[model samples]
Target chain A: MRVSVIATAGNIAGEALSNKSVVMFDILRASSTISTALANGCKEVIPVIDVEDAFALARQLPEGSFILGGERGAIKVTGFHLGNSPLEYTASVVKDKTVIISTTNGTKAIRYAAGENGRVFIGSLLNCSSVAKALADLSKDIVLVCAGTRGKFSLEDTLAAGLVIKDLLKFFNKNPWQAKTQEHNKFYLEETPIFNNDALILEDAAVAALRLAEYYWQSPIQGLLDSLHGQKLLQLGLAADLDYCSKLNHLTNVPVFFNDKIL
Target chain B: MRVSVIATAGNIAGEALSNKSVVMFDILRASSTISTALANGCKEVIPVIDVEDAFALARQLPEGSFILGGERGAIKVTGFHLGNSPLEYTASVVKDKTVIISTTNGTKAIRYAAGENGRVFIGSLLNCSSVAKALADLSKDIVLVCAGTRGKFSLEDTLAAGLVIKDLLKFFNKNPWQAKTQEHNKFYLEETPIFNNDALILEDAAVAALRLAEYYWQSPIQGLLDSLHGQKLLQLGLAADLDYCSKLNHLTNVPVFFNDKIL
Candidate 1:
């Protein structure tokens, strides 16, 4: 298996993405929010690129069927029902509701991945293990897309990506491919067919992420606190949000982007 | 001052690069090769992207005035005088002669930086301290361009870039900006005017490099040996070359791309 981590969504090569499965990490919020909403029983999360588009999509849905969500400059958009905070998404609030979301970085990456990749999976610190398990099961060439802050690399996303890579290595080491294929045929036909994991090769970007994860494995929150977006969120009194996003492998749901929605 | 480390030459934004002092790093071994040639009394090194262009430029130069040098798949060009090996460039061989070089990655980044940046500098393990000193003197925004393996991030160049950024941080901590501006007036007026380094800000890409540097500080060679390009070089019995490229702050000559030549 070959894995590549794109440092930022801005420079993603569209042609290269189509053949590979993409897992996007916007650990500061978007990925976390979507994952949480889905875990809490949201029917689907529609990631739109623009706030206007989110509004338009919401208007088309029945009044109680959807909730307007997302952020601009780390704050909830005016008239939106919820902000881009995973903590804001509760089981009672998101149950069977559709989330129409737009965010500064994550949604753009999600949309790009949606258009370019056949399999677009959402990941964050909250659900990285689950994400890794799903990817390793497919055993296809994968690309981890980091929805970087304003077209620049974000440390938070890279850390989450590293964690996923770390977990993937563990899974590959513990389970033989022959064993995995027989047991996990759940999405084999619809998505990628299983391939033997004889060797796992990580590209340079992925290597960097894995190294960061190893370095900060002792105290991952410190790394998040040191990130550009994390610092901005801290300044905006969203330390709790950062804390929420930093929880590792706490969620079991993998919100996969299929047919223009994350479910 | 703000600093950014571009993971690869492929995704460099032209507009952002123009105002920043771009430092190109191709650790194994274009940057190291150029630094060695310059330190050994070469007149100049002209970096061209294509082998055909290198041949065309060499043809234009008077015979014996310049030597055609560079590599394709880590080997010297068929008709060139030297390969992309720093060890090949010694005082007796290259003194008082011009080097027209082309490489798989390094030269392309050099050409792009030359076209876009007002000031283009070369860096590697051999001359990272020199590069950092020169950048600190300028006291302007900087973009550390890592000429990655093949349109992807290379760990060797990232580690080198990290070493430079680490040194830059040291320079800021040890000396006041006002003092630096007084002593280094050589390229101040012609290029970027010195600014106060009261609080040097590093972009996220730079932060990643710095973290890598900190992680590998005790065993820098191990990091290089672990890189994809480094492994390939080792397989070809270029272990000595990797060891040579891993030397930190061994060279004093800072190669600057000025008026079409790295001098």
Candidate 2:
């Protein structure tokens, strides 16, 4: 099975990944937030590219059945129920509501991939290992699509994509695409030495898992709450349940986005 | 002094380099070639944004007294006497010649900075240290304008800019603008370490400088010379001179472009 990791959806020259298994990542919170919302018993989360679509979706959902959430330039929209920060969501707020999200970069990237011809999965560092496991289990071609910042390659997004690549490498010898992507990642990783800069990789992972677990352990989504995307959620006051979501493998529920809905 | 580096010319939000010191880097041969042409006895090098403008400028020059040279996708213009590789402008070729040159990205960047304020010095790895010295001497304010890949930040250009920052730190404490630019570059430098892995610092500097020194050296611009941009140049048959232009600090000449000509 061939597996490839595209740096970003913007650079997809001429529909290259049309039929591949595509996992999209927006680790600075979009995918993580959606996963969190669904895990916390939200019926569904609809992503829109712009503010108007978000407003339109909010109007269509049954009255009092949904909450509008998302941000532009890291700030909440006026009068909206929420902004993009993941830390604000709690069981009291999202237990039975739907979420309408509109973001600057992530939603646009998601829409672009959804338009492509393939099975699509929402990805984030929070559930990166799980997504990699899912990719390996399928034993087919895959493309890790990073939702970079504003139509350009971003450092944070690329690092999360690297996490997926690192996990998938445990299961298979890298194909040419995988090799190039890995080489590309290895280049950057060597520069910062950020991951291994401090002691105890296990401790760091454990703490990250714990933080996520604290937020949404029982809600279903777990482990992702510790990712870079997850931290941003904490800032937004959206997912006060972030600590519960950090527990690694607590729910075993892998939320997969298919042709339309996520299951 | 406030010193800021524009990550890419595309991201220049306001006035570009007005009443300030700005260094422009098109390290993959354009600025390096221009530097060499000026240093090696060229009478003048006129940079035009489009090929038509170059032709127009050439026609205005005295008949048979000037030369036309440059590349579109790294290849020589049809029927032109020279290509962009700095090595092609040895004493026999460019000395005493007023050459008209245009390239895909660099010329556009130069033209883009044409009307803006401040002194503009063409930058390259070949003149990295000297450029730093020049900036230190000016000691007012500085902006490093990266001639990025098609108005987007590419690894090579940003890294070269970082190299400039690293050198500049030796002479002065980073001012507020330099601090911000450094912060921005830290992200890109950390993200593209593969381009610098295991390579000696001087070797890395020379990698982009050697383009002009290519005929002087026996090798070609080896090792991943075929990138999206590099391949464009190769397809135009401009690949052979890449090695010469990629060398570091080979041309101690710093061609200052202000008003219109390379001084």
Instruction: Encode model 1's per-residue lDDT on B14-123: one tens digit a residue.
Output: 89787668898999999999999999999999988899999999889898999888999998899999999899999998999999999998888887766555468999
Write one digit per residue (lDDT tens) for candidate 2, span A1-263: 44444545665554756666677777566776777777678777777777987898788878889889888877887767988755556667777788778887777777666655635778765676788788778766666676765554333444455456556655654331221222322133223211122221211111112212222223322222212343344446535344433333333345666555555
Over 4 Å off, model 1:
A174-198, B60-63, B116-118, B174-198
Worst 10 residues of 1 chain B by lDDT: B186-195
What is candidate 1's CA lDDT for residue A217?
Answer: 60
Model 1 residue pairs with clashes: none
- Candidates in order have lDDT scores of 0.80, 0.58
The single-chain TM-score for chain B of candidate 2 is 0.74
Model 2 TM-score, all chains together? 0.62
User: CA RMSD for every model?
Assistant: 9.6, 11.3
- Docking level of model 1: incorrect
lDDT of 2: 0.58
